[model samples]
Target: MTAALRATGVALEAASLIALRQVALRSRAEPVLAALPGGFATRRKGHGHEVADVREYVSGDDIRHLDKGTTARTGALHVRQFHEERDRVTLLVADFRSSMLWGISRAFRSVAAAEALALIGWQGVSEGGRVGLLALTPDGQVAVSPRGRVRGVLDVIGGLVRAHEQALQSVMAGTVADRSLDMAMSGLERLAPLGSEVIIASGFDDMGQGMEQRLAELARRRVPRLIRITDAAAGKLPKGRYPIRLSDGRRLRVSLSGHAQTQHETETICGRAALLIDAGSGVEQTARLLAANLPADRAP
Candidate 1:
């Protein structure tokens, strides 16, 4: 049933793309983009450069990469052209640790991850790319390679939703699995072979000193680009005098009423630090940050 729901959602998503905006023309500063590396520029099917559509010219905009085929029809070189692809694999990683359940905004961390992942996958499909899936399973994790097929991406997401649902059940039933970050690292290893852009979604609460060391090692050795998700509650605690319950039946609270001023000051600093070292996109909230940071057109 969960699988079915995911499939239906995926179908609806693809259907929704019928309304996606397209830039049938190119601008002076624009070039053509290809799905695969080294894909060449070609002319638009019917028209040659005579008309063009202009859009925001990002700094990394490349002149040579423009599809003269498109411009030849529009007759201009305006850059931002959006296209859809049939197959491109997007890999998504979600963190299911208990910490993800916070947020005074009534929006759980899991919801945030889902929203961002959905937007990212939607953007991927808009570009005619396929989305892949990699996620935590409480007992372990999952990995799906990049595929151009829409069904493939849906399957991955369905598996993820089921895995998360099952994990939650296990916790309620008190059958904890021997899980760790190793699952994520191992999954990433599997995903690495695909050469697809990987997006790992996590609050990374388990990053103890040991885990942090391991992550640093992974960063140094694997050279992975990560996007970290964060929540307001995860940032800091104001001077407070209320108790908070723990999943393990224990309780704790902030009693900074005495040091409200001091706690508030400390919290401010700590909040920034946490944001600086977030799990995935780091400080960037939007996914385009990655594309934006790509080396600007060096092909002068």
Candidate 2:
């Protein structure tokens, strides 16, 4: 049992590292960290790599320092231009209420879901993108989105883990998973035309496909992605008909002998459901399947 637990930890850590590496590469901040911004590459007047012809300086021009050659040619002092792009925002939603607290593995569904959110948020912050938590449950509060400093990334992950522990200690699942199911989708709907990237991280064990259908509508407007985190237990029941004993000592036999069929059904549901959110696919064995479906540009 101890060995099995250790193996699980190793797998989880490996999964997080894989996601972190991917985010680092996609951000492309390695070599440039040492050099000041706009210093490594020579600035071109136009989009080219070298000096193109220059024209009269405009109000929007940088005009910090103009190219002498361009000034000598047309006699207009214009600042050099460089390549640039606007940063994109990635909204992440985490559900931590009743439904996610139950699972079939060493970790419950909530733990895996929180793990996915942590990695994805780390990626968004590392890439200098805006990250926000749209909704949360049990606690009935949102972080209001603090700036994604490196320390802030670590803090958010730590806080999420701590929050889970507190929930367990305090027994805060008094509310049902369906407490705000429709309302949650309503919040998602308001974020239409996400323009940037939208990521919804949840066990997705809520009530029905109403929120999912709304998510499908939202997907049409922007770069949409879904990171689904599920463990083997949540995917299917364990094999054999063992007595399911209750806390009150009541026992019932469950007929899960057809393990293969059950597993197939669970996988099918997860896959087809993901299609509704424009997600390519997902992972059922562990929380690491996020590497494949993350934003390509944000990959290592």
Candidate 3:
């Protein structure tokens, strides 16, 4: 590789690492007390022990939750209401396909996706919740079960870094795979428990058949988040001929002067997601968007 390409690679890696560290630090100051409340709201009522209120007993109210003292004093039946404590499992799914290997801006889409995953994992862990990862690489899928504390977050980050390195190597060797995002989503369905909060980060280039059905099923029981990693040049190639080098030491000239945009304008996953991340926006911008969208007690 040329010195310029190597330098760009290094810069991309460094930026991602910095973004991870910043997210970790910020999470310590303000924990995600609620399970992604705003966009990721589960809409399921809390079942915690903390009393929220009390009201007259309804026909369908749980008889066991009836307030005995209140019923006796008022000569009427009443039920105790408790505050809802959200489930604490956070799962991050990332795509590492060959398509992510290309970038027209500062760095590859894969790098940005990795950075976003790291940030979200760290943030979830800092809030005293268990975090896990499901990585879709050129070779196959890698799954990491959720774990509590900082160590779990570290493990997920390590996996992301390794996947990014592997993706770069695959691109160089012209050995990239054409895996679909649906495979990763299927893995998520099996691993993630009901009521878990899930965030999927990817370019979403290859969404296989029946993907909509899978997403809908997951959304019914879990809070879903989507991060769309894309290049600035996607669907907007300049009007000129350009020389492109292939991984097999071959150069090809391509013209885009009259090429109409062929990429899809929207993603099916967006319909089921509460939040979306545009990788072309850079780390800081993405982080800010997450902080704003995520449900937390204070600004992260």
TM-score for each candidate, following the candidate numbering: 0.53, 0.55, 0.67
TM-score between candidate 2 and the true structure: 0.55
Pairs of colliding residues, candidate 2: 22-300
Query: lDDT values of the candidates?
Result: 0.45, 0.48, 0.67
- lDDT for model 2 comes to 0.48
- Flag regions of model 3 displaced more than 4 Å: 1-19, 24-38, 41-86, 233-237, 243-270, 273-276, 297-300
User: In terms of TM-score, which candidate is stronger, 1 or 3?
Assistant: 3
Best by TM-score: 3
Candidate 3 displacement at residue 30 in angstroms: 10
- Best-first order by lDDT: 3, 2, 1
Best by lDDT: 3
Q: Please provide, for model 2 over 67-86, each residue's C-alpha lDDT reduced to its tens digit, 9 standing for 90 to 100.
A: 77778877667666643322
Root-mean-square deviation per candidate: 10.7, 10.3, 8.6
Report lDDT (Cα) of residue 193, candidate 1.
34
Candidate 3 lands at a TM-score of: 0.67
Model 1's lDDT to the true fold? 0.45
**Number of the candidate with higher TM-score, 2 or 3:** 3
* Candidate 3 local lDDT, 6-118, one digit each (tens): 65533235345645766545644553233233454333334767777989998999998999999999999999998655447889887877667667766777777777777
